[model samples]
Target: MSARSEPNEPGARAPQSRTGGGGAGARKDPGWWGAPPAGKGGGGAGVPEQKAAGDPRTPKRLPPGGQRGGPPWMGAAMPAEKSMNFGPSARRLLGRLRPHRLQLVTIITLGVSSVAAAVVGPKILGRATDIIFTGVIGHQLPAGSTLDQAVAGARAAGNDNLADMLARMDVVPGVGIDFDALGRVLLLALGLYLAASLLSWWQGWLLNGVVQRTVLRLRADVEDKLNRLPLPYFDRQPRGELLSRVTNDIDNISQTLSQTLSQLLTSVLTVVGVLAMMFWISPVLALVALVAVPLSVIVTRLIAKRSQRRFIAQWRHTGELNGQIEEAYTGHELVKVFGRQREVEAAFAAKNEELFQASFGAQFISGIIMPAMMFVGNLSYVAIAVVGGLRVASGTMSLGDVQAFIQYSRQFTQPLTQVASMANLLQSGVASAERVFAVLDAEEQTPDRVASARVDGRVEFEHVSFRYKPDKPLIDDLSLVAEPGHTVAIVGPTGAGKTTLVNLIMRFYELDAGRITLDRQDISTMTRTELRGRIGMVLQDTWLFGGTIRDNIAYGRPGAGEEEILAAARATFVDRFVRSLPDGYDTVINEEGSNVSAGEKQLITIARAFLAEPSLLILDEATSSVDTRTEVLLQRAMAALRSDRTSFVIAHRLSTIRDADLILMMEHGRIVEQGTHEELLAAGGAYHDLYHSQFTAAASVDAEPEPAAR
Candidate 1:
């Protein structure tokens, strides 16, 4: 059956409109990351030019193309984001952090030292309490003079146990209490606290550096991985979500490291240190404190098990929301024109609500751990006071020891409570790390082979076959040849594998079967860099960075001279409008080229192609943006540009490609007809039908008289 014009009808991809690098996917009008940034060049009365990407704290950007943008507004429903298993994610994160082991060890050491000093202060304070009590009980020595000599006399007689006993007695038994001893013990306790504080601050400062360096390396890795990803990867994934992983997810990990790492180490150390001190003072009371441990652990486990899933869901929702925000923000103009703002807002609300719920649940559940822990801690405190009071009355334990044990018990539970509180946030960070690892673990593009010299433009597709998905073949056993310096026109309906060919030629996709060659050498054997360097393309859609007009044009040949840049701009008619602008070629084209028209963005791409000066050229609807007269001029300029280059022009307008030396009419991934325009028209096949259907319809429209004014 003869194919029909349906590329723009519905459910079809716009040509070469995927991905961008204009900083947040602003690559022409109506782009996602490459989506329409200004909303279809559309700003109806109610349509806003830009919508919020989401909360400012969570940064996101939409790339250009056909993807959706903007977050769910206030109340429409969207699916909740999904969660993943944590084991692999956690292990992957550990692997990334392993290189920083030296820094981590230093941090842990400082953390332990600081916590240990603090833990000992309570025990020292208890000695001050004992001194004060003894003075009130009249057990103080007379200026602490006599017991010192008795201790030395006992040691001289080789009675070490007697010396220890003599040291326990006051200087003059039954004299006054030791006020001087109490003051010294209290001062020592204060010193320990001050030292602990200093060490803690130093460790915090060091840990910050470690996190910064790790995340910096992580970002670099992600950027490199993006370039290595296959085109099909972008085709399937959302740019905003990927950006979330690269930016938000990494930041989450960074935040967790900075806030939770030192605290975690301190909490663990405090638990151990306090437990040891409690046992040293009185094992009976220490055992009472141990009672709270199991209860606290059981509560934390119950809450964390549930909170972990919610935290994972929360991060996932964040990425999903980011994707939607990128879509809505990029295409906000569309929402207004189509009267879908309410719908978009509803969607936004739904997504926002979902994120809110996930976050709330994770936090609320984790929040329970602290209070629950504190409750058990209070119970333990009561139990200790009761047990220690009985021991003190029985003379089995000293009053000072009981007081210190009580303090140690509180200190012990304090860290466990803190750790429980941090559990949810740490889980969130781990989940985010897992998301990042997914990108790092994705199948990278096949490494390029040996670099080759400049292409001669002789190309052949021999028995090639490919499919985006295994069940849906896009190209099958297709074969063709393009002689040096010859123009080839590829015409096909929507989904007829027209644009897919460009992807294949540029090595954006690998072939499932067969091979392509250039100048008798297989293209697959050459590095992608070598093959792409020799080829230049001006796609139907255009991409311009956030820079001056001159920068965008010279993107293909960054080292191009001013003279060369001007010549390319002049050739593409960009110089004409550029001169009209205030700054001429230096005028900045904002991201998405929102400051200019769509056609103008396309023309910039044409100028970029000219600057590249490659041996092979592919123009897919390259001149579609210009009017009749402008297109004629463009065609002339393109002809001059293609003088010695092998060119492939994929166009819907037969007139633009009438001069093509060979025309291949494609349908269902197969070439149904091949010949020059004159030959195809005479044969009255699919090509003939397409031409007449287009021209005759246009003629009839032109022939119709304008309706008479009322």
Candidate 2:
């Protein structure tokens, strides 16, 4: 029963032209690959210009400071460079943290409390210093000498500066050092310092959790968005670049938040608290320190503006470089087979250089802020010290007050420096957020209908019109029908729309004009899950995930049992070879499935389709990889499979589809002929020419003379 009489010899395949566009190798719509127009989230401000036209080998140009556009595989449509949305993206990034507002407010409160306590500690310690100085001066004076008398004695001794200094010092005439008061002040300062440290630590711990949770939600949203995107969107994007957005870009955002959030809050609060203390202690010195504020702001603004652009370039180049690396690694065998290793290496080097330059520019520019801030801070420090000394000498300020004011000045400048550094992280994080947001904003597939209907294996395409572009019509008014339990065979040359037809039936895309129905129920009325649920498909390219063979087979039917899996495998002859292997069905297949032969891989797919028990079946060049003997067995199994289900088979080989109930000959997305095999040959039409051409070309190749033995 497995050996039916073979029909005419199979046809020799024509050479296929390679193209970068089209889905399933069925169309030649070149416009689909064109670069997206400007202002559509595509190319804009900072992108590098394209290389020479029509030369895929030519490398793209680099922008000033070495930023390269995306790799060619991204089709020039992926956003290489554009106007930055720093303010908007940063706001949106903060919006992602809205759900954790309570935690954030708590963290801010703790930051304020901690900074306030630390700010007071310096003043308390300064008071202790004042107490010790006064005790020393008071101990040296005569027991009954008043402050006026002490000043007179100093003036009489011709030490005018000492008299002026003594006038500023508040010394009781006979009192020595107050160890008790100094100890109390020191203990109070220590307690304040300890409390500030504890509060800051607690705030940091809470901020870490809040930031991690926010990032977790962001990552989840991106994952969901990716799933909702249309197939055409994926076709337009490079896999490596998209992965970078999902993984690398999100990771960068997380790092930025973790490094910046708590520190920025604490620094800002510290600045406010210290500035208040500075003014209270000495308005004159506080005003002097304020002089540096304007200078610091101007320097930070100028550098951050330039570095923001660089950060955007840095992350974009990172994504593009990742894309190129992925493409090279994925096709390494092809590169080796064609001996294009040098070319691949050259492309990688070019992109790596771009990344290096971008990273260098961003880091170098942002790094300048820290040193500039330090210089400004030092200038302010000198001004504050000189003014404080004069105030103390004039008796307008106590020595302790001047000392406290000096400490406040340093505290103030340090936080300003911290804020400036945090700007670097903020810019980098926002740039990454913009990239992640772009994915979330992509156009999604049409929403599925809430209502659904069960399928009965009757499929009809009615007045269907569709195209990948506005001017390029791939399928125009195409119509077909297949009755229940019938085997429909579709044969065509490359780009003749054989695969597109099947894809249409699966609703991988929507029709532009008419409708497709299953058992008289409009397919568009059903949810995609419900519509695709009852259909089983096997394509020419076998896809096996990294799992055991048994698991792969079970993928077709999620809850399929051991008995069902075994029966399906046995029916397709998969069990015969699988049992011969040492581990049998438990043998693990690697990600690429290189451990299995092409023919064996094809059989496993057939077995998977068998296990699905679908009401509708599609096989696109399903038996092309198997040997003649194995092909015969698969045809027999396919026949039994189609006995009670509607089946659509797309094939190049004529011999395998001889027994089909109906044969459709398609060209240019239209069916040119349709009939039974014998009927078509009798008519001597397009089908006859196609059938005989295969037999004749194969026969001629077999008849060629072999080289004679010497």
Q: Which prediction has the highest TM-score against the true structure?
A: 2
lDDT by residue for model 2 (1-710), tens: 00100111111111111111000000011110011000111111132211110101111233465343333332223455866888999999989999998998999998888888888988997899899888988999989989989999999999887788888787888889999999999999888888887887889889899999999999999988976776556545655567677777787787778767776787778778888888888777888999999999999999999988988888888777766765555556777787777766776787678877887788788878878998999999998889888877777887788888877887888777777766767787898899999999998989887666666789999999877666877778888899999989998777777776776677766789899889988888788777778888876767666689999899889999999999999999999899998999999987567888999998998899899888999988899999999999998998888888999998888888888989999878789999899999999999999999998998999999998999
Every model's Cα RMSD, please? 10.6, 10.8
Encode model 1's per-residue lDDT on 1-710: one tens digit a residue: 00111331111112111111110000111111110011111111111122221111112233345244333322213333556677777777767778889888988888788888888888898887777665654463344456666568667988776556446533364566676877788788878887887887788788778878888999999989987887656555555566667777777777666656666677788889889988888887888889888898899888888888887777677766666666666667767777787767766687678877987787778777767877998899899999988776555766788888888877877777667766666677787888788889899888877877779899899999988778888789999999999999999777787777766788877899999999988888899887988999887656566789888888879799999999999998888888889888888887557888877887888889899998999888888877788888899999998888899888888888999989999898889999999999999999999988888898999999999999
All candidates' lDDT scores?
0.72, 0.76
| Deviation from truth (RMSD, Å), model 1 | 10.6
Sliding window of 10 residues with minimal summed lDDT for model 1: 31-40
